[model samples]
Target: MRLSELSRRSGVATATVKFYLREGLLPPGRRITATQAEYDERHLRRLRLVRALIQVGGVSVASAREVLAALDDDSLDQNERLGTAVCALPHGKPADADDPAMETARRRAEQLLELLDWGYDPATGATIPAYGMLVTAIAALERLGYPCTVADLEPYARTLGRLAVNDLDLVERYGGTADEQVEAAVALTVLYEPVLLALRRLAEAEESRRRFGRK
Candidate 1:
């Protein structure tokens, strides 16, 4: 397809696609004429993946490019995948031992994880980085004695689990005959906490509007 068509179909503007090309995130298309290039299905697939990582996963452009490159690498092993998952989490410098806020969040994370039975091992079965992040955040809260209890987190966890099941079902609707779709969904699900965070913000905004009787 032409660049314009690729842009339209991908829901990304032509200029944005060009920016991706310039950044080496999207490979150059086949030259068809002096002013035209043809992008194939692979480009479309990759562009969608790129958007998901950036817009959904909240990864920086540089980090997303790096992770995409690693995903495309056929030689990547399980360890590489696990590392990628870790970096995709909400990252920051290591918390200082004296930082009270950070300490509280870490403790709350651990407490909730224990209550939720969320194992923190990255080498385990069906590892989900979002779960790790949530646990970590709860741990931090606990350290501050923020008064979060398992009962408080349980409703949230059940809601998230329902959303996850729905999201997985939606993936199947995309016709997963290809292995890449399955892989993408698996990776996406494992790293989906960012998306969940976005949803929570949206819901909170809407709820605030309703409470104030705003249209």
Candidate 2:
């Protein structure tokens, strides 16, 4: 396909496609002439993934590039490749536990993980990428006098564990290549967070209406 055709098929502007090529987000097309380049479905797929990472996932260009690098790395196995990309995403930056509350929060996070027998990639430590953020958030809650006990969090943890299994099931069943798996994982993780939050808020509204009739 020509540049224009690729642009048309992808619904991304030609200039934007060119920008992605220049940024190395999309691979260079085969040069057919001094000015003409040929592209194909592979380019289209990559272009869409890049767009999803930046536009939909709200990742910075640098972070998206890092994820793309992970997808292209052939040395790592499929799981490692996916993990590298996921870890590269700019999720909540974990703050250093410098204060007493933060230190206490870290302890609580460790306890929750232990109670659930959860671990990060090391398979023994409560050191997932978002673990620090979890600790920081819990510290804030405690400081605000709204601390959640481990018992209060266990139900959510159990429910989300099931969700994780379902999420991975979708990726493994439909995600084709290693690159495709990474893309699927990133896309699903980024996209569905808002879905989860919206559902929670909507459920809260419903529960409130049931408990105390809406004004």
Candidate 3:
């Protein structure tokens, strides 16, 4: 397909496609002439992935480029590729280590991981964002005067662990290529996070209605 055809088929503007090509987000199409290039299905797929990352997943172009590079590295195994993708994705900012709430949350997070037998090194960059999430949640609960014990949070942790396992399984089994698998992982989280939260809110409302008449 020519650039115009590629743009039309992919639903991305020709100018944007050219920008992606120049930014190295999309691979160059085959050269047919000094000024003409022909794109193929691969280019279309890549353009879709790029759009999903930037538009849906809120990933920056630089981060998307890094993820694409990682996916394209044939030397990386499946686990490494997935790890690279996760690390490349956006994460919550880490809280200062010296803060008392952060320290407590770190300890609680470590305890939870230990109880679950999930070995994670605190120094790993991949684990930092997760730690930040844990600490933030814990701090929020504490500030609200509804601090939860480890046991109280364990069920939710177990459920999320199961969901995570299922998500990874689906990506590995159905995603055709490494790049596709990474894209699926990012898309699943980015697109479905709000859906999951909304479902939980609906469930809470339903439960309240069941316990007390809706008003």
Candidate 4:
């Protein structure tokens, strides 16, 4: 496919695609002429993954680029590469833990770690990425003086865990190979949380209204 077709098919703009190419996040296409390049389906797939991580997953361009590099590297297993990318982000920005404003932030990291342990699935045994993201979020919260607690996040973890189970079941229903399943799982782990969190909030509001016998 041509660059325009790749952009249209990937649902990303041509300029953004070029930016990705220049950043080395996406691989170079085969040059058919001095000004024309041909991309393949792998490029499309990679673009979709990159878009999901950045636009949906709320990752920075640099962090997303790191993840793309890890994913593109053929030497590691898919899960290991995914884990490396997840771990590579500057999620744990240091702060003055002794500062009153940072106390909550410090505790929040601890609580997030506890939540990761709490939410661990024995079957898949995948917990690192969630831990990485949660720690990062908590660190940001600390900077804002809004350190979260395990008690504060328990309801969220439970709600999100159930939704994750549903998503996992849907992925497994397709009945593909283990690698495909792992790939889908990695995609879901990275991509689904934002959408699920938004929908869950809506559901919680509706449920709260029903319980209160209000419209």
Best by TM-score: 2
Whole-model lDDT, model 4: 0.70
- What would the TM-score be for candidate 2 when compared with the true structure? 0.89
Off by over 4 Å in 4: 88-165, 169-186, 213-215
- Measured with C-alpha atoms, the lDDT of residue 29 in candidate 1 is 99
- State the lDDT of candidate 2 residue by residue for 2-52, as single tens digits: 999999999999999999999999989999999999999889888888888
Off by over 4 Å in 1: 31-36, 55-58, 76-108, 122-136, 139-145, 177-179, 182-215
* Candidate 1 lDDT, 1-215, residue by residue in tens: 99999999999999999999999889999998998899998899888877877777677888777666666555666446535644554454444455655565555555656666755543462245554455556656666677566678888887776886786677667765544544466456635666677888999998988898645
lDDT of 4 at 211: 92
Candidate 3 C-alpha error for residue 49, in Å: 1.9
lDDT of 4 by residue, 70-125 (tens): 66567888667756765644443433335554455445656554566754443443
Task: Record all residue pairs in model 4 with backbone atoms less than 3 Å apart, i.e. clashing.
Answer: none
Q: Each candidate: what lDDT?
A: 0.68, 0.83, 0.79, 0.70
Looking at candidate 1, the ten consecutive residues that score lowest on lDDT are: 122-131
Order of candidate numbers by lDDT, starting with the best: 2, 3, 4, 1
Compared with the true structure, the alpha-carbon lDDT of candidate 1 equals 0.68
- Residue pairs clashing, model 3: none
